[model samples]
Target: MLTTRHFLFFLTGLCCFTISLRAEPAQFEPEAPAAEPGLAFLLPTDQFLRQELDEPDDSDPLLPPPLEDSFSQVEPTPNPDTESLPDLKTLLRPRFDISAEWEPEADGVEMISSDLNLKLPLYPVFGPPPPFLTAGYSFTRINAPVQLDLPRDLHQFSLGVSWMRPLNERWLVRTMLSGVFATDFYNTGSMAWQFRGGMFAIYRPNEEWDLAFGALATGQEDIPVLPVIGATWRPSSSVKVNLMLPNPRISYLISESETRQQWAYVGGGMSGGNWAYNLRDGSPERLNYREWRLVVGWESMPPRTPGRFQSPGASYLIEAGYVFGRKFEREHQAADIKIDNSLLLHSGIRF
Candidate 1:
């Protein structure tokens, strides 16, 4: 018997001999003629090539064929003319506006006096009256005095918020709310608050002209109801001049008493110009009492783009007024109490 290695070598040699004997050559077919080197091949079964050869090729301009004018006699359809549409932007308008201000002031005070007398003297000093003389002498005396010192270092602040809504391109409705806070004059460490609201009919007929007519209402502890008619003229964007007639209603109670008195006042104020930080004193007639106040202060609106009607980022206001004159009292039988003039100042934000 042969070894396993010799038998494996003999089987490999026999497989190689069998593979060489089975190898065969492929049969060749004849080649067709080549027309043009760059031309794409077309199948013999293509539909266009199967049609009749008599039809003329309209694609090749260099090859002219005999033609009758019958094809040219076909009429062409005409297209209707259409107009271009206008853009939406050209049919609409844009508007913008803004208003705001700040005010601050210092100095304020109040004083009071009272008379404790209730009865008249029995004896007539000048003349004899038939019915007046009471035999017994009973005299009633009246005398009382009170004084309040307001804080000497006083600060008051105010802020205003205004909105303007466009009515067409040149007109707007304007409204505003303003609030003020300051240290109480008599209480020293206490605070006082005042609020005011205004509404206006504003007209801007041209770029260089502005006019407004409005009414304002202001409220506080001493002067609870203040109604005013206001007008403003703006010759330029940064300049404004204003005039106002304010009717202030004042209410006060007698010292250590429950009796309250209410009175109305009509007054007027004038400011130099828009950017001017000066206000002339306002003088108004008192209805039930004689009272006077002198105010000098500055107010300014927030800076904003001319056409952007929006809330001001922040605003400040200041006012300093002095109260003088007299107040009558039934307790003070002989004379009225004099209110010494004092300073009031305030400053704050609009929000």
Candidate 2:
């Protein structure tokens, strides 16, 4: 039902309206010319599971970087425009993200969640080196009305490796493999384990455009595998258009200085997770919750360091959104419960 309404369609309409009112035409000058494009910025849904390369170096040039909803970081690509590879030391820096989200009581339920993710670059003295080693932990607490049948607490722990290898001047391959344990902590076993993986071919014809095609395995019941078709288009120095599944957004540059930049964005996406738990009857079951989100947010980030590759600098974001199409389903049940739409608040800091 929610998919039919296509919340993403409405989000796109609203995003375009905001862009038209504030976006201004500006000259485009790319100082760096080339680096690994940021897929995390392009696709927020898989932010924690993947890696992105390089931070936004405001001085190095290229259109202003787009807003990142999930703050995923990856390894930087060696500039294809240059003959030499990027210095290994520059790519070894680590990036960290911390975020929290809340949905106030609505339709008999409320939820709060927090996440911590780290992206660390890895290298080997011999053979090819892996680009990144990522680890994350998440905790969620749900307060439900007496009538609801749900677990009060849930947790997820993940570890993964991300790799990016350039095929040529304009093409690159990025892939990630991760194992996740999602449970109520009471049900800690194979039943709680889930595997996620993804691979994409990215095409950066120039500094202003990036096109990616691939699929992501989410390990959820309702939609286990999600296709990844995404594009990033910078129409001007002040505006960026991101067309991607699960999360799509348009961002406008609000202000900028030599060391920092601020942004405003409107976007929407699918948000939910699945976990395993033991029922009071001693039966092991899986619970899946799903929803759609429409959000407007603001963020601030430091400029990219010159010459040295860096993850996105310490940044912060605050967002408010509408959550709809909410539902809870069980692994082998004939019936599901639906909840009324509600408002959500989210904020995060990354360093």
Candidate 3:
């Protein structure tokens, strides 16, 4: 019975195949025209249809595929114009620099002292100084033997202004007027006020060089005169050296700006002067004083989108120095004056 059933199934499949073979074949027609020489496979049917709908039949040939980037290939087309642009370097350079320093020190039981100093319009106080003006005060104390230290406390205050104009590119005409008030041994030092006038010239041959010569005439019960000449050289942005003649003073300044907006400066100089006094007889008293100063200071400015003449900045400075000088009375005086070398340090801030 099972063999008969298998034979019946096979006969049914053969009959269906015979009927399919007699049916006519359905035909396929090529949708696109024949391919042309040099042409590769045509774009997919959907993409070809979309391009035809968007562009007119007379459209220009589509751009060639970007040439393989070989040395002989023509340069690629630049991108279309856009608003975004690269930053310019000229806008990134810093335009101005500012700095300051201070120092103070303590001696033994004899004394404790402090000094405050500042510089402004810091780029060499350049241009014809138009109406230069300054005001400052100083205080000092002494703790020696009462007989030798009458009026051991001292105070000095001053106000000064000057009018300066450029005589030429390298020279200037400088005239100044100033007044001072102080308490000291000299009548001028004790006076309520004193006046002074001076004229000076400044010559700068180039950005790295400077020369200054000046004579100051001071008015008081006793006249004091000062004639000075000085020069400076800046070999690099971070280093400066200076020399003064006659009194023979030398100075150097070094500065650097590191990351984190940290900045530092080191400056030092040596200077000397002479003092003279005439005794009752023909004998004369002379004193020689010399000092060496050193200052190491740091500063910081607020984080800024770097630019020129931006405002609202502050700085701090610390400095120290040593001074050694001799105060000589007449040779016949009871005692030859002696002063120990002294050290000073100070700190200050500016905005």
Report lDDT (CA) for all predictions: 0.26, 0.64, 0.35
User: What is the TM-score (0 to 1) of candidate 1?
Assistant: 0.29
Better of 1 and 3 by lDDT: 3
Local accuracy of candidate 2 as per-residue lDDT tens digits, 1-351: 234243454345334533443322111111222232334444334334433322211121222222221122664455643333445544444556666677777777888777777666564442143456788888888888755668899998888876665555566576778888999988887879998877877776666787778887776767777776777777776787777555777889899997678989998877778889877676788988888889999988665443333334457788899999989899877789898898877777666
Worst 10 residues of 3 by lDDT: 29-38
Sorting all predicted structures by lDDT, with the top scorer first, yields 2, 3, 1
User: lDDT per residue, candidate 1, 55-78, as tens digits?
Assistant: 111111111111111123454333
Top lDDT hit: 2
Q: Please, what are the lDDT tens digits per residue for candidate 3 over residues 1-351? A: 124553454345434433433322111100111000000011111111111111111100112211111212455555432122212221121111111111122232133232222112211233212233344444444454534322344445555654545444455455656665654423332233556666656566665665667776654332256564666555654444544333222223333343224445444443322223233342444322234544454545332211112223443444455545423232234664555565544444333
TM-score of each: 0.29, 0.76, 0.48
Best of the candidates, TM-score: 2
**Residue 319 local lDDT, model 2:** 88
Using lDDT as the yardstick, the better of models 1 and 2 is 2
Model 3 scores what on Cα lDDT? Answer: 0.35
Candidate 3 wrong stretches, greater than 4 Å: 1-109, 112-129, 184-193, 218-223, 245-312, 326-336
RMSD of each: 47.5, 10.7, 37.9
**Location of the lowest summed lDDT over 10 successive residues in candidate 1:** 29-38
